[model samples]
Target: MNTPKENTYTCLIVEDEPISQEILEVYIQDCPQLLLKGVCNDAIEANTILLNQKIDLLFLDINMPKLNGIEWLKSLDEVPEVIFTTAYPEYAVEGFDLNALDYLLKPFSFNRFLKAVNKFTGLQKNLAISDLSSDLTITVKSNKKTYLMKTSELNFIESDGDYLKLYRDEDCIVIHETLKAFQSKLPQNNFLRVHRSFIINLKKIDYLEGNQVCIANQMIPVAVSYREGLKELL
Candidate 1:
């Protein structure tokens, strides 16, 4: 028999309809790996919870009173992984465009809900897998000189339009690389791209003063989109 799964994730339901909320609650309750944290009739209540607590998944509805789900998503500085629940199919493209885990139509079956949960879990597994690299030394070709550097010796990475600034404790290298492509080669657990233009080694955090991450003597700006992911580390 398979081992019993632990309830490691906290989930929130953001549906206003009574029947829909009850159904979604039942579906969530049956899952061994999910813990229902709260239910919000509107985005305001949900936003309060998000600020005070950490949510792993958000079951969000498109149509709601006062504040709609899409609008709520836009207003959030840091958002949990979301699965959009809607009666209308027209908003599917927009939901997926915002990187929602799944879009569930009205009267969705328990199996369908479970599939969306599985998709979220699968993504978590992939991120964990990427952190399995045991390589110590990092080799990068910059111009005519091939640089061989130890992974632990690096401090942070900064994007300079078409080039990247690889910062070490003693020296920094300006290489012809984009932050996105160069970030892929970095160890996931040790380094994170906290902003569009900056990636920092998690171990090097001096302090977190508001939205700024202090590494060494430099203060790095943490973009709203990437702040939640960094919170998991802090």
Candidate 2:
């Protein structure tokens, strides 16, 4: 049997919510690729640690008490790859502006967490290979079968309860994953979650209604909560 490679990435968590922080720590422990370097309740504490220790990644919260995650990231002379974890989807654009690896909304599942980690790993690999292009392909396993999907071919993805429906030009594929999981796999520059259940490819958008996004002949509803953030992406 081939053993899983022991890849270790030092990570720092800067989240105020105790339960969320605990959940992240547990997930880090479970991931063979991750190593917990430190945890802090706010950016100030995280800054102190950053000055002393070398951190490979950061799991930061957008709504910190004093200095928000975006503010903190801007303040830093050198910033590591970051994955923002927050309850507010309104900060999605700001998170992307900071070049976050992925943005995890609150109440995320283990499967979703894994997806973010996978994206981070992919990013690191691409960086090592000096491939800075956001356009790429991803392999997804569904129904015990692996499918290679080009990111550019994706039009939009919709959540059907627990599963995600990925729509290409004329084809659609149902994958056993959440919208959050699919969001992690996509490049932030090209994809935007216009609703809790809908992630639309910016390049594929034919037009946008008040609360609806049109891709080809299909129209996807955009939730009121996500409209402001979606506008930023547009």
Candidate 3:
């Protein structure tokens, strides 16, 4: 089993064919954003793993022994993000109807595989934003006071030693927390860590040039390692 990297999504591949499974395993291993949790020969084996573990992404083959992929997926009450893999293009229409992320016809290239994975990443980035309610707020504790802060009002956060400064328009609030710890509280769709010491709300960006981002008149430096991810969101 491959160990998952930090901030990686867990993936499960359900394909009966040894050749198809090998191809998918290779493609998944090459993608840093995805971690293969398990590979199942059929939907029955996949179902057992799904019941016992949390799978974020599923690459399910349309045809299998005992239970076919399409029938198995429909039987699930809570389905994960799915991408259908099959030789038959005839199943494409039905797969999309079930809201699968992408349908990959057999003998697909690595580039095609990447395109499907990118679709999943794009959907994940926008999922929270689409689901966000206007009244959504975060409960924050600073000093002895507990404040309810609107997520929409927040601009950016700056890490200062062991403390963090959360900026909201003209107001700033100091909290006793690490940037990484505070990051889990915010929606991953909008909030992004651009630097080791800075996490900015993508919606609140005034202007971004090179490695510098201006959020509510405050300049935040974007680290080189995080530039690619920030660019993707922007």
After best superposition, candidate 1 residue 159: deviation in angstroms?
Answer: 21
Q: List ranges where model 1 is wrong by over 4 Å.
A: 1-7, 132-153, 156-234
Given candidate 3, what's the lDDT at residue 160?
A: 97
Model 3: residues with Cα > 4 Å off, grouped in runs = 128-234
The sequence of per-residue lDDT tens digits that candidate 2 reaches over residues 1-234 is 122344667889999999999999999889878888888999999999999987889999999898988998999999999999999999999889878989999989999999999999887786755434457799977778899988888998889998888888877888898788778888887888887788888888889877788898899998888888878877
Candidate 1, 128-209: lDDT as tens digits: 6665552367778787899998767778899998998888889898899888888788777788888989999898889999
Candidate 2, residue 30: the lDDT equals 91
lDDT of each: 0.88, 0.87, 0.91
Prediction 1 TM-score vs. true = 0.61
Which residue pairs clash within candidate 2?
A: none
Write candidate 3's Cα lDDT for 42-76 as tens digits: 99999999999889999999988999899999999
Best of the candidates, TM-score: 1
Q: For candidate 1, which ten residues in a row score worst on lDDT?
A: 1-10
| Better TM-score candidate (1, 2) | 1
